[model samples]
Target: MASTDMRDGLKCSICLSTSTDPVMLRCGHNFCRVCIDRVLDTQDESGVYSCPDCREQFQERPALMRNLALRKIMENFRHTKPHQKVIFCTYCVDSPVPAVRSCLHCEASLCEKHLRAHSKSPEHVLSDPSTSMEKRKCSVHKKILEYYCTEDAACICVSCSLAGEHQGHRVEMLDKVSEKKKEKLRNIFQKLTTKREKTKEKVRSLEERWRKAQETAAKEAERVTALCTDIRRRVDDLEKKVLSEISRQEKEESQSLSALIHQLEIKKDELSRKMRQIEELCNMTDPLTVLQEPDTGDLCDPEEEEGDKDTRGHVKPLHDGDDLDVAVISETLSTLCDVITGIRRGIYVAGSSEILMDVNTAANNVHVADNLKTAIWTRKNENRPETTKRFMCNQVMSRRGFTSGRHYWDVEGSRSGEWMVGMCYSRIDKRGRQSYIGYNHKSWSLWRYNNQYSVIHDSEVIQLPDKISSDRVRIHLDYEAGQLSFYELCDPIRHLHTFTSTFTEPLYAAIYVYESCATIFEDWLCNWP
Candidate 1:
């Protein structure tokens, strides 16, 4: 029987075989020269090499130093005897016999005959022949771990239960504790398997939604292409508008599905890891180790209330109806007709008005560009010379006002913050909330807060079903017809909301900017082909 130290010394760390052509590193670790050369080659790209044994890194691949003395010793040892390890009975002094079991209490290996005659005590913990016996004994009490302390969730020996740190705790026999833990582990494993399966199902559902959305988007694209071809040269700009809208809707839906699928996959991976850990614990042979292992925390508990709430509340499963169905075929046809009629009838306006921002009516924080077409919320007060016409709030108006003729102007606004665009009386209040477009009887405007869209007049708001897809809005007013209309410049220009009332005074192009900006386009609907 070879000694443990001699056997370990001869084994190479890399290949775990007896060292051949042994070489020593600067870190004082030895390995076969061929093994070291191969390992060093892998690190060449990093410009540094690390010792496999000590993990000590070197700036460059160190030259291999031959250990001639160690190599000579290895050769002699190999020639004298083939180094194979075997455990024998400690009591067999004259005739050595192979050991079948090792006693932890006695710290000795026993042959079959001796094992049969050995004292059957709790302390004499017998296991398959092993060199390390101290592991079976308690580190604190130096006794066999026979009891499991439930309070501490640790293994305790006889003395540990009676007098040590675990004294007076709820204790159970090791076998009983291990059996209970295994049952729990099995239950946890089953739950994890169920969760993983559910996560897989969620992934499949989202993937299916994604596939359907793509198909719907493709069909929409084809229909739009066919429509554009039919319309030909008369509506070239309309084709680009329709295609862009389709792309935007498809992107939003696909991104949502992708995010949900990613989250489900991550949850599935976590469940798999937990299941593997529980399975390993259930199959463990040592009762003490199984009982002494730390709790798996929330990983083992599948029914956590907070986790369930978060999953249900935040990670909502996308409904089958969440596909990219922006507009049905009939709706698209109707919208196309509206577009053609609006183009031929010239309902927007006969000619474009050179609309510009009124610097005098602008709020202190509102910055009107030099071109007089843009108004931005500067946050800090500009301390503009106070005047009776100046607005107290973040509001601005166009330099021109309308009293009779049909007129329209296109204005672009930020999507993030709050903004309002509409027609208001030139004499609208300049002081309080009444000065805000859409808050009083003198003004009517389409208001946008984030993605929501609505029209407000005389403090009465009516939410619009059409979402804010385009930042550009066309405000059309026919002073003689008593009609004020707002249209979103998307696809086939969608009419948002319209207000009809007799005009009592001259109306001005007005806007309210709260951490937002608005810009009037130089070329308007009158320029469209």
Candidate 2:
């Protein structure tokens, strides 16, 4: 029972057993080095390592100090007495006598029955009975390593100090050196833990920024959707108002025609009555009746038809009429313009450069303008031989390639037809059907067909409802930041879309026109003549 109790006292708190490579924390707690390392890893994000027992936080990873005293005590601890109730006493020669105590000096265990008869010599130190004893001896010197050489950072036996490698090294008893190292480690741990906390703060900040950006993008999309709905409603109202005026004018014209027809029918009936009476009287049989008729129903007077006389092939009322007044039509158009111009948003950057078309890179049917700023698609054109730099389809690139700094330029594109504006590396595919802007990996673009706008890259299409204005489109590039954002330059620049990626090559301004045309030019902060 005494031997079992002895083994329990030396058990490590972490592993609940004897510690392998035991070390001490600044908090004076002992554990296996591997166990403490695992705990430190768990708190690596915060950089605030703490003791499991006292929860004393450290600013840095604390260096572990070898607990030589604890190691020494465990070396003599019994390995065999862990499971069995008792073992035969080393002092006994034969028979099964249970061991109670181990003599550290004599290296033998005595049973309680035998312990009572054992000598009471002070030199014969007693401990719990154990079987493992060879580990205490050093492998090199075949002696116990009781001293620690501070300079060599190693434990050494007495023989090492006399003549071996540690002969002149500064050394102390391992128990004494271990205590000093533990205190020094405590100071180092306190200072280093704070640095890791700063890193954690940075990571947290970046995550928050990303989350807020997502929310902002969602809100912007909703605003654009609502704006488009309102515009559609306004346009419909304008259309209905114009059609209603035309309908009112048509009613006025139709009513006058109906009145003229009624008058003509009445006159016809009066003449027919008169003719029947005259014809019967001419027979002489009713001569008296003809004379008594008193010339009644003499063709309805012409004055009655004089009213609205100009109704004879005349329509001056419908032409230059108030219903078709140009002033009202102009005002309606002005209002429509105001509604659209009011919605343009965002700021335009000042940096810009004039971009010129590269005729050599243009498709064979695409006509390059004299100014080198515009390209028109035509069916009749001089055929050009296929080349590596020229496009297979109706596409062209700017002469200047930007590899650094900020660049902002404007391009006027088709308002009603299909067209594309974007950036691409000079080495983009020149022959494949997917070589067109927005369809390949080397290009990013905003494409429009009628009013529907789409952002495309790597063959993936993201449709946008807001009609991208073709009056003036702005492409902003930040080379160092690896960003390309597109905008519609109106009253307030409206953001269309943005592309972000690490650019590895110089980029050229590319324009693809189909059944349309576009012109690119530099906007030098409104200094253009």
Candidate 3:
């Protein structure tokens, strides 16, 4: 019975009174089970609980040991300790425990009865500790960060959104912004890959074309070199043959002159000896006496007279001998000159001389042919209709056309806005009349013209309706197909009208248009030229 009373008399460390539903804390101290549990829960920080009495920490909520025997004994003797009501709080024990001790104001242990008495008093007010602590937290009041603006797909924060700078900007969560950027990066990567492949193909194609061009240039160079070489060889051979013929002719003339001089010298010598003998015979003094003496007289008399005549003839013509020799030498020199002149003529006639070639003329002809081919290729490959359509869509706000000295105008806005304009001429026909026509959007008029200076006609102005904005107008000319079309701005840029004709002399027919502003007719018309 005494042991039972002693067990019942054991006090709670928290209440400082006889155990009431007592619990053993991790420190082995006894307290009311609910009281210790509340203290343990309130004191927990970082998920660790500490004993109130010994301040010993526990890793987790320790197992609660209920003393059933002590509990039953205390139940039986509940009224025995009624006078010992002054209980100390285990957490704060300088004075008696408050009626409703709370952890809100201070870290103090609480008794069930303490809080009720404390609330009745004006000094203390019952407040939710959890709510008051949460109110003081900075994280709850802080605004979340917005990292992306969805309008332009930009990155920004919450402060930027509230500032009027991003009034209409759509914002996205920061976490999602990274994903969006990553997706964009992936798309860019794909585009880069595609571009890389395209560039590689282009490079390879260019390399192949370069190789082919190199081969062509090499072959052409070789051919040109061979032609030049062959020509030079022929010229050299001709020159050599000409020189040889001249030399051979000169040698033959020299040999013939020497032979003629030798023959003339021998004949002159023979005539000289005969004249001497005749002179000797004619000089005899006793010719008359001898004529009567013998047969020799008759012969001597006739010979003497003939010899005197022959001597006179031989001595008579010594004046013209040098002149005859000079004539023969001049004839030989003239023949040599004629042979040299003929050789020179033949050399020039061969056409192998460098001076005959006009390199600049040949190069110019080649250049002209290349230019024509390039022009033809450009005209064929370019889409004239599509280009014209694009031009129409992008026309200036004001323009004009002239016909018969009369100016027509197409205008959009007052002189305040921007403008653009274009004009083009097509090829002409044999009739000398202007067969090609071009339309201007600003004046809503068409002007027909020739490739030369003549302007055929300008159509009457077709005013644009207010509902149809000039910015939305598009014109297309298909000279090859002999078709003209106008389109309104829509999904497909709706065709307003189309004109088809069989006449196709014009290589290209074009139109001009306007959009935002109007100007003087002079300003617009001056643009055509």
Top candidate by TM-score: 2
Per-candidate RMSD, Å = 43.1, 20.0, 35.7
Candidate no. 1 TM-score: 0.35
TM-score of each: 0.35, 0.36, 0.27
Top-scoring candidate (lDDT): 1
lDDT (Cα, 0-100) at 50 in candidate 3: 82
Cα-lDDT of candidate 2: 0.77
- lDDT digits (tens) for residues 266-363 of candidate 1: 98898899898899998999999998998767565545435554544553333456476656423544566776765544434434446778899999
In model 2, which range of ten residues has the least summed lDDT? 343-352
As a whole number from 0 to 100, the lDDT of residue 390 in candidate 2 is 94
| Model 2 spans > 4 angstroms off | 1-353, 527-529
For model 2, what is the alpha-carbon lDDT of residue 183?
79
Name the better of 2 and 3 by lDDT: 2
Predictions ranked by lDDT, top down? 1, 2, 3
Prediction 1 global C-alpha lDDT: 0.82
What is the Å distance of residue 463 in model 2 from its true position? 1.0
Worst 10 residues of 1 by lDDT: 344-353
Model 2 lDDT per residue over 25-99, tens place: 999988888988888888898888898878898888888999998888778674444565566688678787878
lDDT of each: 0.82, 0.77, 0.43
